[model samples]
Target chain A: MAADKDNGDQEMSGLLKSNFGRRDFLRTSAAAGAVALAAPARIGFAQGGPTINMQTWSAAVDTVQSHVNAFTEATGIPVNYGNAPWAQYRESMVTKFVGGAPLDMMWVSDAWLPEWAEAGWISPVDEFDFLMAYNAEAEDFCTNSMTYNGRQYGLTYYTDFMAFLYDESKIKEAGFDAPPATWEEVVEQSLVMKEKGISDYPMMLAMAQESWLIEFMSALVFSHGGRFVDDDGMAVMQEKDKGAVEALQWVVDAVNTHGIVSPACVETGELSGLKAFASGNHAFAMVAKYRLRMLNDPEQSQIAGNVKQAMMPKGPNGDHNTVGWMRFHGMASQAAQDKARAESTAKLIEWFGGKANGAYTFQKFLFLDIGAGFGVKPLFDDPEIRAAYDAYGNVDMIQAQQALAMKKDVVTPWFGEWNETNGSAWQSAILGNTDAATAVMKSAEFWDELKQDY
Target chain B: MRRLFGYEERSAAIFLAPVLAVLMGVAVFPILYSFYLSFFRIKLTRPNRTPFVGLDNYLDLFTNDLFWVSVARTVTFSVVSVAAILAISLLVSLLLNQNFRGRRVLSTILLVPWAIPYVANALMWKWIYDSGYGALNGILYQLDFIDKYMVWLGDQDKTIFLIANAFVWKEVPLATILLLVSLKAIPSDLYQAARVDGAGVWQRFIHVTLPAMKPGFMLVLIYETMMAIRHFDLFFILTEGGPGNASHVLSWHIYVETFRNLSFGSGAAMSYVLALVTFALSYTFIRSLGRKV
Candidate 1:
């Protein structure tokens, strides 16, 4: 007993005298931190949750969780649900995929269809007849957006197009009875609004270098009757009279010459533009159609009751065309290798992307909650859905504009690489660092280079 | 007689094995792996098609116009940021070193900006520099300094400086502490001797104080230069190398090349180049540190 006590006392004295306690605590804390950091970066597989793992950008989190809970209760399959912020979602997902983190299903943007499919990060869902069957019900545009290399990847999460939104109060106050119908008219009305001391910068265009830049530019180019790439996937945007140059030139003149759009528009992002427009500081803005709901929400919008949508202004040689974009649920290629996990993932995807309880429950919930455009034709005719649309937007105008919305011509395996260059080129033109023609040409050259390399 | 442990050297090696293994795992492995990856064409999009492309990535970057532009921007940004950091920290440290009341509280409070993560700091600055509803514009407008809420970050001419400002603010605290340490280490007898030599405050500062700060200056110079050269979060959060690539520095270029373009080989090559430059800089500073003050 004395010997044991002596050993204990000696050990205590050594620890205290050498400051081993502090060192041990720091060492243990560091180990704990390393383990903690490694844990999340590993696959989303967890101890208590269901075997099926689903990841998404944080959007409508509560609604998604509720649906997940219902699915778990009904199918007796638990799910591990996780999400990152929308801005960082793509990088997070890419890192997860490259690190070989186990992902069963996750949200994918239409723009990434070719890249992800090429990387073998995601697998085609055509093998599942039940999921494929709903493609017939989906709009051809949405369905086409989801397909790459003749393989269908997944089902639609939501779909929307860029729309021309105006503050009704601002336009009316600026002595405009109708919104501008052409790019020239847009400049004229904006100048008038500016001259009259109404809106300082009467036009809001988000020319910031981000994911949304390509869409905004595409909409402009398409409406001006320009194609970024030809049917053979060759560069056409660099052509002098092609819509790209004209669209870009107009934006440059708007910022530097007309004084209608803020030079700061080059720094403005889509969300920032939306908030600016809602704050009633601009007479006109170009944003995704779904933003109309938020622009008209009394709690969030300063110009709630007076926000209205108009057809995208036609460029000099172009029609009122716009860019359409969509997001879909993707099945990880790894998850498809195991038949059991495949079935569980498919059921979960179906539950969210397709019919839930045989009633398109998830789609209805998503559309109603967020006002995201639905791909199903049946939902368009639903009275309640139509009424919700009528409250915030013109149903006729929405259909007419959406009909002209085109998928971005730049979608390819090398789209991500090309997009960075293209976005910078456009911003360079807007900032007068380069002329419109050079910007368009630079974008075209890079696009072609990437195409050849890929 | 047989002993439980091996030879002294062998026992030391055995004891060091775990730490060496960890260093190899975390640090040495990644560094070497990236260097190896720099030799291949590791496009993530074309994962199955990685062909060893022998120094081509480096050649392409060195030849590219955009790469040169990014290098120039990085140099300018680093120089301006480091200069600002060194000057401001020197001033702040001198003030904080004094035996004033609330000195401790003030010194502790000085770390608030340094304590915040660079990302959080970037976000705060983003709001402050916002074109609309920005506190910068609001305060300037209220002060009658400007007739309008002028573009700040969006102004291509001023973007690098604005980003540099935020970076310098976050970096100054650590540099100040380092300077304060140097000040504390200076012998009081030196200052007394200078006074006895009929030196005034300015002369004493130049003769006694400045020379003693050589080590601190060396530390601050090396650290801040490396940090400023690689600083990414502010540019990413604020401009994303825009208002037309005005703030497009080498670090952003590497990020765009790697993550956005998914060209890991080229990204690795750029990183290795940066690492080499950093090492050369540190070596130069260390050599200068050994010089007479």
Candidate 2:
């Protein structure tokens, strides 16, 4: 009986071992099949190229998406585009960059370029072959705006400068056949327009706590033969030669003494001045050249077809200098750390902004579609582009003149801090809460502190 | 060695391991990291250079006038907005608790402001407060409230109040819902007993209803105060701490320090100060409530 039991146990153990071995073999085969199925797809993706990721604010979402789609179609490399609202864009970008997220390229404003490049947050593009294809005008502009410590970090995408957009009908009603030639003439014409009842608020100035005020003040100071920063790159607002105080005084007088500007100007944001001018409630507004399209659009502007652009009125110093704003596409240093990805991103930027394809570039399309001015000279001189802008009456010339009048070598790494401090000081002065001289002095002090911290 | 905990305790801990890990990653780690960062001088722009600054960031902030101004503004905003929210919420909850026509519909409708996205709500209020073409100016002019349109956001105090009102409009809904739930939880027999003792409407409310809703009131007070003190989006969109830093609060100041100034160390220090103040206030309220209860 014991021998019979031992034989049965041996049989059971052999059967169990055989079944386990068979199951293990089946499982191993299934795993190998799964790997075989997925390996080709993964390898294909790897060989295809690294996907490019770009970030910007909502303002550039449409332009970026369209250009990214075209680039992807031309090259099988996929691109990921992300955007946040303008208010959150700076913080979001900084967080993503500092968090070691995968950001390849981004649209940075001219004001932020200095700080970003100085801190080595962006990769220098001077060595890229595609950079050599930029036209002299575009290259000079980009180099002036994007160069930090003599190394280029960006490619110019779009350019906008502050200019005077006036109501032609109102100016004519006020007995002025031409735009004001000087600041004095501006005040005189504004008073005339007010007396004629053509506009309740003859001057629409955006004095809100935004960069608009800083841009306007910079233009004013530059036109007055003053600079925001000295040769040493220190804020020179308190310097007597820098007309910051006088320029700010003019802004305050426009609101308080002249009564030509609205008391609510302190609440006006970037677009509010343009809207106020477009609504036919103001005879003149100092705004960016980008407002040309909106001013000419019949749906958006009540004064459509009756508005015209001109260079900013000259200051007492007899200079026509204005504040130039440019937007650029910059490569992230982290993205450029990988040579292949860096090459791809450089190609994408060249396809977007370079003259390699001439009029076929994304920059040209952007200018034609939205009336945005290209940083490239040839595009600006193109007959089709000129005609497209001429439809808006001398817009092309006005933008060119504004570009020529841009203050040279004024931007500093502390541009953001300078803007905020000066904006608040000017806003307070405009609201009659503080004197212009005192405000400028206070802002200078704040700038000094900012410099110390940096 | 003998086991410190039995199998049941070990099993419970094993079951909670995932949640504990998540909390450590999200909450505990950030708090610890921020505290560590507060002792160093760091700038997001200058990522490669971070030097230990010890308590300089905190000392500098305490000496900074702008920091103090923001703290004062935040305190005032919290006090006024929380008071107004509590009053409006209590009244709404009392009204909703009573049987009325369309009570359910009204309760649901009250939540619309709170349901709307904060950005959208802020934009709406910005339009309403617009001086030139805003609905507020238009309606007030039509109603003959003023001879001319007033710039509501231009004045510093008016801007703060307008923001506070918008905040109350959004916050009162949740407060009302919580208080209403608390009101409902009170037995009807207690009200009957109060009525049998000849308690009038006001007396019944003070005697029985108030005592029952004390916990709910304390919760609303604590939550709303914290929310009001950290106000950022509305002020950012509406006034941007503007008309000369009149509407600036502690959170916006921290944002300026961290993002705009790129001074992460200073921002971290300010955050700790804000956290400490909030914790102190919350503890005080809870402790006082505990004594009362």
Candidate 3:
């Protein structure tokens, strides 16, 4: 009995001694762990429902889940989700629509709006008064997005506009005080950067099919004051402006004359270009704002702090134009619930655009450019958030400049049929089968013929 | 005792009913439904917009340049890939039939490429063919074999060839394995007898092994052609039929027209056309091989 009592006492003393010795250390670790765990808790409280479906980019799914978790915490909602890559998402959406399956809501690219609306697949937002309530206070959100054809079809959750990301250290080493302010300067700086061996290449633009060319062409047309369509929506290729043509010539020269970019640019996709820029192989890359998150991740990036984002350079018109790509979430046509439920869902959309939620979603999922109609205006007002945008130095300023100068794509009428045609023309041009002028001209003619039938 | 027409009709019915029911439910229904859909003006996104258009969908497909072009490409691709695979497999099988050192190790290694996933294999080859900093171009440049990089999959004219190369590399291994199995099954006594008669390696192969492996060759031809016809992943990952639709096959056209464009009627109609072409080609191939074996 005495021996047993003595052993218990000794065990108690050991526990006490260890606790005393590591109190401070254990306290700090416990606090850090709580902060980490708090993220999921916050998510649970924000989302009130048991589940909601979302169709977001595969790359951005994790970032979205964090927000969804926070939403659940705030509102006691649960989220059951499915995700698809951007390319496959279109196919899946079509399949789901055709099969008449159960779907609550899905991410809709702006390019999909006209088709979805014309097809009558998406529900009208005007039926729910929640949008109007939010629109009154946040006019910027409604005007810039959501409002298609005078009636709002959906709400914008996030937007990403294209911009140039530069390695400031490399550029400074090349004797440039600031980023190239114009297209001419971009070319000159690329050559200069290449000559000094600061970087083996000056600029990297994604020239692959579908994704990059769509953005690149939009930037060209916008900066050069070329319009793809008239007010009447007739297909017009106003190459007479010469500025858009100059942009095309710049791309051609970047390949053949300047040789600043690697021939691999023609083969690289957006994600690959993001990888290359984050690896410090290229000094500058034409990319969207979303790349910032990947660049910031220490585990995935080697040049984390060395890179910065900036607006794409301007043309002779002095306007640095970019292509603004926005994604909106709309209720499925099959979701014919009560008007009150839709109003509640509409309120959820508003909540997504609300200040706190917007800040959370943008800082988390939207690491690059802020989507309009959300809390971008208020989120940018916070100095800490602004600083985060420029952690690599002046990136925020450059992105802001570009966003201010950005323009919407022409939203081609025949985008459905001839989407692959542009890639074909670009590839043909790159392979020396035909020159850029011929390719662009031929695309213009094709675009016209395509619309003629429509 | 209740047999009719020299058989137990009730017993036969009892055995066949379940199988017939399953077939009707699984196979015949879907085929008939697809055929039914092909006759409508259906849009995937607008399911309610479907209207019976009789033979218009098929007629429209016939007039569609992209459709006809994709069909031609699919046929050409199927023929070249099947023929190349068969030829390479036959040669490899012949090589493997010989008694050689470390033959097992070599045969295993040859099958490794086939074991990998098709998409993964295609991606691996894509990286190798990458014009900028791809391993293949990098090595070629180092060796001074080429002055500059070539976008192997970027140019439309070269894309089909690149895709074909990837397919052949992936497929030849399986064909070789199958052929090798058949070759081994050939009676060694025949070879011994030929040898006794002063028959050389070439003569023994031509007279004995070749005759024994006719069934295997035909099987490879049928399987490879069908596989080549149904392929979507290679073209999807490689070029997506670019440089002006040079590599775009009928399968991809069916996909784009159905989903991307959301014209399900047209997509279904195109798919039916693809199915018919494949069936006809497969039939012709089997017919030409004859049935003596």
* Cα shift from native, residue A91, model 3 (Å): 3.2
A300-348 in candidate 1: lDDT tens per residue?
Answer: 9999988898999998788999999889988999889988788889988
Q: Please provide, for model 2 over B109-162, each residue's C-alpha lDDT reduced to its tens digit, 9 standing for 90 to 100.
A: 999998998999999999988998999999989999888778889876687888
Q: Model 1 off-target regions past 4 Å?
A: A1-54, A65-85, A95-104, A127-133, A334-349, B1-15, B99-105
Q: For candidate 3, lDDT tens digit of each residue in B1-293?
A: 54563467877888999999999999999888888888898766555567899999999877777777888888888878988999999999988888999889889999998999989997898788776657988998889999877666665566787788889999999999889889989988988999999999889878888889987898898889889998998887876666457787988888777767777777778778777877887788788884744
Selected candidate, larger TM-score, 1 vs 3: 1
lDDT of predicted model 1 = 0.89
Candidate 2 lDDT score at position A325: 69
Tens digit per residue, CA lDDT, model 3, A1-454: 9999999999988876776557766988899999999876665435453245445557556556776666657766565567888868777777777666656567777777766766666776767665555454432523345556667766656666666678888888889888887778888888888888777667877777655677767766666556555655554553655424456666777877788876556667787777777778778888766566567668888877767766667777537666666676677665536443454455555545443443435333454443222324445555665666556445446446534644344454357666566666666666567777777777777777866855
lDDT of 1 at B243: 78
lDDT of 3: 0.70
Candidate 2 lDDT at A8 equals: 100
Question: Of models 1 and 3, which has the larger DockQ?
Answer: 1
Q: Point to the candidate with the largest DockQ.
A: 2
How large is the interface RMSD of candidate 3?
2.8
Residues A231-302, candidate 2, lDDT per residue (tens digit)? 676767766756477777777888889888887988888788788788888988888887877898899999
Q: Which candidate is the best by TM-score?
A: 1
Chain B TM-score per candidate, please: 0.95, 0.94, 0.89
CAPRI docking class of candidate 3: acceptable
